[model samples]
Target: MLANPALNKLRQQIGCIEETQRRFSRTIPVTEPVDRWLPYGGLSTGCIHEVKGTNLASAIAFSAILASRLAGDQGNILYIAPDRSLYPLGLLSYGINLDQFLHVSTRKSQDLVWTAMEALRCPQVSSVIALLSGLDLTESRRLQLAAEASGVTGFFLGHAASAPIASPITRWKVSSVAGKPGQRFDKPLWTLDLLYCRGGRPGKWTLEWHSQALLPIVPQLPAKQAAREALAG
Candidate 1:
């Protein structure tokens, strides 16, 4: 059997191009605790990630926070929702640049998926946040491929109760946490459960949003009468 030299040369060229793309692609830095669990040490740009929560509101907030980071100073974010209920100004509280965000409202489920895939294919779009009830694994894989080709970050925000699909490199579950009695809590707190992560270990932690960062919450010990209570015996 004889091999074609021209075909081998073409394959070698394609391999070089793919290697170059991997070298130049960027990653969006999440918090230390979260990034530590990711194989890339951060959220890789050319991929899809999912955020699920006990309540959709918390999930939206968490995704918005990630979008804010992904947008950086000059990147543009495309936000696609089922309806026009999203208030763009509300994202300001998360340190997002409202001017850099473009919200698209589509009620149709297929349209939502189509719009997200299109937006992800655009190189100018730094990130895309799609609020959906659910999507099949094939649709998710299409979104992932589009993002990978354009070097864009994509997020699927949905309810944690929904049946899990495929294609996301990481899936996070956020559950709101209440403050202690008579305590003054200025930041939003959540119990984050890493539902699954490809090529990384899953973990759970209690974290709070403070000063534009997600920080792990550490329990405090009382001064005098906490010895027996701390021992839990």
Candidate 2:
């Protein structure tokens, strides 16, 4: 006798939930304040995360920080940025080891997307970060499935030039914020808004990516301290 279709579908959903729970039981470390809104007190390792590039500076900084933390020093990270203008030397201040990065510098968005999808399917990589312009629902679903299958996390970095694409488990919007005074360059401050989360309430937080006097940015203390240091000098 054939089983009921509706019951079979429900069973499939339940199984997916259980399996996903088991796979994502471990969480990637995030900033303390930001972690509060995340499920399981951290970002899931084997999931797809979205970071929009409305403010290119903040968006890319946010992605780099997490990718560095998650990749640690062992696992490979595939970064597909077709038109990335970032200086590789400066990324070292953010704790990103150049050796662990596999940078895909392409001239076309189509090739970038293809490379990202393929990277996501590879289990050896810990994470795949792609700066893609256009993506349809079907393509997003394929990427999502690939991420799930490999149990490797993915980050889709998009910009306002194209509407948001992909139904990721979590989405974030990062924008630049003013740094304290006496700072020759801003300290990479950003207001992070958690646009959506699968099992958590959305909220916002501010983050300052600590850095030394790296190129494209210079060192400075918090405003008050900087003022005092200046006065003493």
Best by lDDT: 1
TM-score between candidate 2 and the true structure: 0.78
**lDDT scores for all predictions?**
0.82, 0.77
In terms of lDDT, model 1 sits at: 0.82
**What TM-score would you give candidate 1 relative to the actual structure?**
0.81
Q: Where is the poorest 10-residue window by lDDT in model 2?
A: 211-220
Candidate 2, 1-233: lDDT as tens digits: 57999999999999987975666666876776666668778888777888975677556667777888788779888888876686777667677789998888898867877898889999999888888777888888889889888888888887635577768888888877687676534357666778888878897776666553122233447999999989999
Lowest lDDT sum, 10 consecutive residues, model 1, at 20-29
In candidate 2, the residue pairs with backbone N, CA or C atoms under 3 Å apart (3 or more residues apart, or in different chains) clash, namely none
Clash count for candidate 2 is: 0
For residues 99-131, write the lDDT of model 1, one tens digit per residue: 898989988999998899899999999889888
Q: Where does candidate 1 stray beyond 4 Å?
A: 1-25, 180-186, 220-233
For every candidate structure, what is the RMSD over all alpha carbons to the true structure, in angstroms? 6.3, 9.1
Candidate 2 stretches greater than 4 Å from native: 1-17, 184-186, 211-233
